[model samples]
Each structure stands twice: as C-alpha cells, then as structure tokens.
Target: MQWKTDGPRSIPQAFPYQGSKRALVGQILSLFPTEQVPLLVEPFAGSAAISVAARMYGRAQDIQISDVNAPLMDLWRMIIDSPDDLLDSYTKMWHEQQQGENSLVEAKAYFMLKRREFNDTKDPAILLYLLARCVKAAVRYGKNGDFNQSADNRRMGARPANMQERIHGASRLMQGAKVTSGSYEDPLVNAPREAIVYMDPPYQGTTDVPDHRYLTGLRRDVFSETLQRAVDNQVSFIVSYDVVREDNKYGEPLADDLGLLHRNVVVGVSSQATLVGRKEMSIESLYISPALVQRLGGQDKIDDLIDVEPKTQDALF
Candidate 1:
C-alpha cells in the first residue's frame, strides 16, 4: 500500500484524526527536498499522516517519527511491530460492540470503558480503536493528561473494510520508521545530516493561551530560535503554525521577527465556524528555514508550494 499522490484528489488514505493533514499531505510532499533526503522526520506525529505519504510514495530512505504523547506513539509502534495481531484484536472489539439488543448502549459502554482503561492498559490497539470511535476524531486530555474526550454521538463506527485498510496502511508506513516517545527537541537536535524535518506542533493560539488539550504549546519567539538551531546544524525543517486570515481570525500570525520564509496554505471555513454571520476563514502558514528552502530546488518549486489561492483582501479590512 504505497503512499500515493495520484489518488482521489491528492488526499491519501489516513487514519481518522481531528486535524488530519490528509487534505494537505499532497501539497506538503510536493515541497519536500526534490533530491534524496537521508532522513525524513515528523516530530509531532499526530497520526504520522505525512510520513505515511512519504513511505507510500517512496520519498525517503531512513525515517524518524516521534511525538510527545506516549500512548499515541505506543499504538503506532504496536501496528508497526505486529500489524496482524493489532488488526485482529481491533476487528474483534469493533464487532463486539455491534452485538446485542442494546448494541448502541453496549457500544457507548465499550467506548467509555476503553477510554477510562486506556491509561492503565496502555494497550496500543484500544487507543487506536477509540480514536476512530471517539468524538470529532479528537484526542483531548485533562491537566493530568488522561483520555478525556467523549464517545461519538452516532451508533456505527467506520466500516470494517475502512478501518482495516487504514490499519494496514499505517503499519506499512511504520515499517522501519524510528517511532519514539519524547519531546520534539530530541529529534531536532539529533536529526541526520541534511534530514528533512516536518513539524506540526500544538498550535500557537489566538488568545496567546494554550488550548488545554494541546498543552505542549510552543512559544513562537523561542520556537523561531529552535528552527534556526536546526538550520544552523544543517538540518532542513518546516513548521506549521497559525497564520492570520483575510479577517485576522483563526489565529495570530507567527511573530514577524523570525526571518523565516512562510507560505500560507488557505483552508476554507470549516462547518464549526463560530461567528453568527461571518465569512469563512482559516489559513495555516508554513515557516521554512532558508537552507531547507534552498534544498527544495530554488524559487520555482517554492513558488508552487506557496501556491496561494486568490483570497479576497477585503476580509482583512
């Protein structure tokens, strides 16, 4: 199951993730170093969606993937180490909840139990199962870092075939990829010479306050130095963060003093837009280091990657 660009749109198959980059992987991959990058790293491996694209497409040789969330990494490690066993266990659990006269009740009960039992069990498969069955495809946590998100409002989960494909695909992506549990800094500091590092950290917030769920908030000012460190050490890094919209909503732009090249990827209004009669808005900026930009084969490729859509400027006014 190779990661493919020639798919339905440019979206490759990915696990159910709330902020899944399935829609954006195509564009991101197109911007990776056009030559052989020794190592490809995703520090914030939420679903490891981008690396899956790299693996599926044969983009790089050595891969290093990690995340701060230990349990989430555990699930991915399980799939990579024992794809068949994890798949079997997940399938059984999925079907079990569909049985009995009170199937919906049974399903809800099952989800809650797994949600509660996750920390204790540290069962990779259970966590993966819940990610599919959980609300909004989200993974939220309490201050103590417990699985605090609720179960889905609906009765049915994803079809058996769908889950199986994603399980297999993720397993394939994880093969030989250095999956680890720790802060993003380790991978950045220890990155292979000329490795291409793609980072999607807990977002910088609009209120300048961290979303309690994504508590591993980064300080833009400090983080800019982090990106610089990666570059100074000869590592190519790309970071995804909030960019001001045409209406100055969604989130504030990365601090202007960083001296990094940013490309705005326009994402239209989501269904959950808050304003009563507001126009659609939300754009993410990718701050790429100069060395990485140079490695991406001059301004032509960079221009394509930054391929900004025709946005109405009036919204900003």
Candidate 2:
C-alpha cells in the first residue's frame, strides 16, 4: 500500500484519548529498531500514537492494532478502512448541532441523543463525537458498560476540515493494517518473532478506581503472565506502564522477575497538577524486553535515545 505524500508532516492523530502517547511518539519511535521491521503491533491501541508515528516514519512494513473496547476498535477500523465514510458521518453530526435556535442547548440535547444511540448501537461516529466533546476527552463508563461522559458545552468537536484531513492522513498511513477488537493477548501471543509489540494497557491507578477509565481493567497478574509468555516466546516488546509525578508514584511497577530492562523517561510537567496550582514533573516508565534491549544495543544506548540519565525502577519508586 503506497500512501501519497500530501499528508501532514506531523503524526496524524484521529482520536482525542486522554492518555494518548502523542507527546512521547518521538522518544518511543527512537527506541524501535532503526531498520524497518516486518511488523509493529499495538495491543492497547488507545489513539495508537505509536503506530501512527511508526507508519509516518516507515518504521514497519505492516501494523497491527487491537483493543479490548469493541466500539473504540471499530472506530479505528472505520478510520483505516473507510475514512471518508467515517468523516462524512462525523461531519454531519458535528454540523447538525448548530442548526438549532440555541446552539448550546441544542448541542447538549444532541449529545444526549447521540449518547443513547451509541449505547444502543455502538456506532463509531457517535462514539467519536462523544469522545471529542466529552469532558477532558476522558472515557468514562457506567457500571452497566454504557458511555457516560458528558459533553463539553464550551466548544464543538474538531472542525470538519481538520477532522477530514486527519482522518484521511491516518487512513493513508495505516493502510493495509490489521485491526481487531478483543483480548490484548491475541496480538501479543500471535505476533511474529520479528515484530515489535507495544503495550500501553490501562494504567494501574486509572483502572483500579471505582470510576473505570477503560472499558475493561487489565489485571496486573494477567498482564505479567502475558508479558512472561511473550518473553518465553522471545517476542520483542516495549511497555508504557506506570508513572511518577513529582515524587508521587502511581501504580505498582511490573514484577522484577520479568527481567525486562527498565528506564524512566521524563515526560515533562503534569498538566493536571499545574491546573491545581502545583508544579510537578511527570516521569513515565518504559519497560523493554531483553530481546528488544539487546537489539537496540544496551541500557546506555537506550538511555541516550530518551535523553534521560540512567535510573532504575527502585530509584523512581
């Protein structure tokens, strides 16, 4: 699949997910094999910033994206397979809200209608609108597994023209990719030895709360075992899991028994803390499989790529 060069130079992001790795694309991609690989796989696939970046830079000849959330994965499917249809549906809904006498009231009402429709039908367009307009673009779910986030009345979702460009751009880059909605384990277990599987499962802090951040919460033990299986299979992988903000660590670090190389990547200050009148640096944990670490040289080489001094999980914790 040959994509045209008319797309934006920057990585094209099609979703407004809160924990997206859009900011860390450069650092993450730098850690990938310098030579293009046969495939790049993302199991969590939220926003798929890494996949998008990989495609943009020709880091992989093929890409595979999977997520537990069926509707969310369906949106990615639409974006990759039929971007124009997705764009048209989203644009129509985006413009229809303004047709009413009072735009705000109408927008709220339109949001409610779409939310109901989304819950009932799992339409990708409605989910896209809800995510774009929802508060902080954070996905929240009711106990019954319904889309429960409210609309941000101050503004409409992404402008149609911009959305179209992004949709088309992402579609072009992610062309010929295999996308699926199911267990993250599927992609991990099935990934070829030469493929690099990137896992960004829901952070332990976010998923363990009463208000679930993801549609499903991944158990730590299950995840550990999954990584173990991947390691036993000699699959190269990287994980963006856990973080520490201003000396306050969120979630437990992965078990040390996995023998994965651990490094802390400074991801800049915390916007959430800054909003509440505090300045805090946000540092994220990057866990690399031994095979990947060996392939990328060694601990020192990986450290230099991310521009962070050598540090272990114990120091960060």
Candidate 3:
C-alpha cells in the first residue's frame, strides 16, 4: 500500500511526545492489507496520535480511543467536542497566571502549573497545550495524582497555532472515531471480535527521572488477563514495553511469562540510569492467535513501520 504524509511542517511542534508511534504508523499501515483498513482501535490511547495520524492518512475507517485517566480523557473530549471553549478557558487562565493573578484556582491549576514550570512561563493555554502535546503527553504526578515535575530542556513551539491545526484536523478526522475513559481491559472485553487492539502501556520498570506516572498498580493483573483474553479470542493486538534484564523480571516477564509474540522492534537508545550506555532498545510483542497473525501476514508488515523526523527547535512561550 502506498503511503503519503500530510499536515503542517511543524506538526510535532504542536503534538510533542516520547516514543510516539506516529512515525511508525505508516509502516504498520503498509503491512495492513487494504481489506483491513477500518476498525482500528487503540486500547491504551495516550494522546491518540497514532490512530489520529492513521485517520489523517486515510488508513482507518473508525478509531476507538480509551484510557483509564479521566483528566486525559476530559482533555481529549474538550479538544474534539468543545475546542473553542476549552482553548478560550485555557487562554484566559494562561494570561491571568502570567500576570500573577491567582483567581483561577481549581483542578485545572494542576495542568497550568505543570506546564508553566515545565515550559518556564505562565501561559496557561501554552501550558495546557503542552500538557496535551507530550507523549502520554502527561504531567508527572505523585501517588496522589498531584503534578510535581520541573520542565526539562526540551522546548516546543507556539502552542495556540499548532494546537488549532491539530485540534481542527483531529476533530474532523475523528468524526467516526470514539474516545472513552476506562480500564484497557474493559474496552477489549466489550469490543467487537473484528477490532484490532494497539496497546502501548506505561513502561514497566524503574526510571531515573522518577516523575511521570505511566501505569501504576491499579490493574496490572487485569492488563495481563486482557492480553490473555485477546489471544484466546483470536483478536489482533500489539503491545510495546521498555527493555528489562532477564535477571530482573519485575514480577511478570514481558515476553517469557506473558506469552506475547516475541518479535522485538528496536526503538531509541535507552538513557535510564541503570541501563545507561546499554543500547536502550525496546520491543513490540504480538500476542494474538497464530491464525490472526497468519491472516495479517506476519511481522514483516509491522517491521515496515518507521518514525518521522523530529521537528526543529523553537521558542514555546
């Protein structure tokens, strides 16, 4: 299948992420036979970038995005259903915060402060936009879900301009797509048999930068059970995870114990303190039934997915 890139040149500037599958969506789509164009589902939709891009490329007919995080889901809904109101509210909050105004205080403040501290300014819209932009694109939180992280050197571009285009494009393309908030297992348990599940769970392991909260202990067993059910039901699914040592299985061995298809897709080099200078490669394990793999061809199709080039640096305040 032929593939074409769409959207603005500074698209990533608007939608920043870590280990985003946006670049590889094309390769994955290329592997997908034309007949399998629609019914794409992202069970763990962090930012929904992959599915959104898939729709933009005319690859999928419908996308079902689900996540357990309420705030993230709320943000997604606001962007798609009420972008104007959301942007206006965020903009007002941004300007007020910039002027040192403290009248606007609420759950939204968590997002605003995180963005400001991370971006080094008080532009609420830009901050909220950044919070929306990052991979999982989330603000780091503690056990209580309180935002508590300082921004690093990674600077993004103007928030409003890029956000407008992304929101507009995503909102239009996602007309048939549905976004929901719930456990990953819930959607899969209730989804149609023909659905394809793309799982990008939080990296399971220790991190040097202990700020971001990916997936916690809420439903670890449930996640594993869901994968098992997918395999039993002959559903097609792909799961991505961080690299871990054989000695340290972290309770559940990813490929060995989990019974995931043992195809390792090389990702970026790891910079984790424990694995510093260690090649830093990640893998995508396929765990659906063999019949499903045969129906979808094999790893050759998935191996073709590639990443797009990162956007140029710019001032984002």
Candidate 4:
C-alpha cells in the first residue's frame, strides 16, 4: 500500500528505521477528538516519524519534538530548517566515504562518524543527514553516547535519489515544528493543558550489548510520574510501549497503573532480512486520560480517526 502525504512527491516512502511507526501515524491521530489543533509534543521523538505523520495527516498544528540525544535533536532541526546546506554536505561526505578516501569503516560507520563530528560543530543540519545515512536505521548508541554499531553490508543500498528535493519538501511541511535536546520530563512542565503528548520511550527489556544505553535507565517510576503529571494538568497523552508476555516480569502493568484508556495495535518488527532471523513483533499500546476520552466525544470517533496501511512485504524488507 502507498502511504500518501500532502508533502513533496520526491520524498522516498521508505525511511531508515527498524520499528518505524510511519505506517501507524494516521491511526494514532484518530485517538484525539478535539478539532482545535493542540500543541503536539513527542518527548522521545526518534526520527520524528510520528510527529511528521501527525503533521502530514492534519492531526496537530504545532509540534515540539525533543529527545535526550543531542545528535538526534540536531538532526531534526537541520532536516526542518536547512535542507540545502545539509544535503550538500551529506553528498560530499557520502561521495568521499564511498571512494575509500575517508578512514570510515563502512557506510554505517561513516554515517555515525559524521554525526559524532557534527555534534561538536555548530552546523546541526549536516549532522541530521549524515545520521539518516548511517546508524543501521535504528540509531543505537552505547552508554557513553557513542555510535558503535557495525555496518549492515548486505543492505547498503545507494544513497536515496532526490535527497535534496525530499529534504526541502519535508522541511516545508514541518515549518512550524520545534526540535530540542533535553530530558523528556524537563520540557513538559509547563505545557498547555489541552496539548497532546505522545511518548515512545525505550522498551522495558534487556539489551544484547551491556552498554547499549537507549533510554539511560528510564524505569517504570519515571514513566509513572510523567503520566501522573500530565493527568493532573489535564493534558491529553498517548504512550506507546511494547507488550511483553504474561510470564514476563515486566509487561502491561505500566499501562494499567497509568489509569488511562488503553488499546493495542500489532506492528511488524522485522523489515530487514537479517532481522527476519528473529521472529519479533511490536505492539503499540496507546494510553489516554479518561477525561480526555469523554471530552473528545467518544471512543468510536477516536478509533476511526487513526488508520494504518500495511506496506508491501517486498518494499519494506
């Protein structure tokens, strides 16, 4: 299925992501009932995929995208504000890395090296484009905030065609969005009461690499306090988290304690051939405040608002 948007036609349908909700943006938007465009805040806005989709589908007006990772936040700002300069720098770096003129280990390594270097520099847009090229699509990092993933030699496809055009198109679409670097809880302290907050944090699970610090030790307590604060302030919120089996020690209890309406949507976790070796599935559990649900009119209308279009298996994997 073709996921259409009211943005640039040159933008590629496939983005660099392992568990991207690019297909589920429409569905997530449907959960909201207010016609007024509330400020949409994505605290852990990885790749800003959901925020981009929310804007594209006309779900929200202004978006506040934030992440704890400085490099990732720089990338979002660049993608939205300075597409031309970013694309030019990315093209030069990519060409140099491709010709073996750079000491970069591979395409993925080259992508991370550029991001690391860009983080310390003043130019943030260039860092974003370089990240899109590197990072194994998932953008994993070690505890020291180091990009330490091996290149996926098998899926090293050519640089996306019309890169500049797509960047410009997306930038135009995201004109009003703001990107920032900080802890998720710090920025939302004074958010508008009517605003909608979407939280997609690191899953509650063990990591293969002992130091693969995706969330910096965000446990159930932190998530609980965040939700309680939003609830007290009458802020409508939606949280997406993985579903662990009943036997597992950690699972739906997190959502249960939040005291909000909950719903589960199944999503494919494997888009790469290498990932197919592990039969993994991702479940998105959306939690909303009870008052917001009633105020939005009803649950049925909210359900109809969100939609998901499954992509062709061949196209994604």
Best by TM-score: 2
Encode model 4's per-residue lDDT on 73-163: one tens digit a residue. Answer: 7766777777666777667765756666444456556655665675457365544454455446555567665555445544433464556
Q: Per-residue error at 85 for model 3, in Å?
A: 1.5
The residue pairs found clashing in candidate 1 are 2-56, 3-56
The lDDT ranking, best first, is 2, 1, 4, 3
Q: How should the candidates be ordered by TM-score, best one leading?
A: 2, 1, 4, 3
Q: Positional deviation of 46 in candidate 3, in angstroms?
A: 1.1
Highest lDDT: give the candidate number.
Answer: 2
Q: What TM-score, over all chains together, does every model reach?
A: 0.85, 0.91, 0.69, 0.77
Model 1 vs. true fold: TM: 0.85
Residue 224, candidate 3: Cα error in Å is: 2.5
Candidate 3: 10-residue stretch with minimal lDDT: 308-317
lDDT string for model 3 (185-293, tens) is 8676555666666766776542224564643443456667767776776666656554333343233445445455444332333334335544423333323444346
Instruction: State the weakest 10-residue window (summed lDDT) of model 4.
Output: 308-317
As for candidate 4, its clashing pairs are: 26-307, 27-306, 27-307, 30-305, 30-306
Model 2 Cα lDDT, one tens digit per residue, 1-317: 12223232377888788888866666677777655888999999988888888888788889999888999989998998888889889999999988899999999899999999999999998888898889999998876788888899999989999888888888899999888898888689777888999988888777666668888888899999999998988889999888765455577889999999987776656667788887766677889998888888888788767746235544432
Which pairs clash in the backbone of model 3? 17-135, 23-306, 23-308, 27-305, 94-124, 118-151, 134-137, 261-286, 270-280
Each model's C-alpha lDDT?
Answer: 0.70, 0.82, 0.54, 0.61
Off by over 4 Å in 4: 1-15, 100-130, 133-135, 155-160, 206-215, 244-252, 255-257, 267-282, 298-317
Candidate 3 error regions (>4 Å):
1-15, 31-36, 100-138, 151-157, 206-212, 218-221, 243-259, 266-291, 298-317
lDDT of 1 by residue, 1-317 (tens): 11137642333343577666655565577677754566899998887777877777777777888888787788778778887787787888899887768888889988887777886777888887788788877677666667777889584577768777767767766589888898888798568766888887776552233224453556666766777677677777778775555455455655566556777765445434544566655556777777777887765568766545445666422
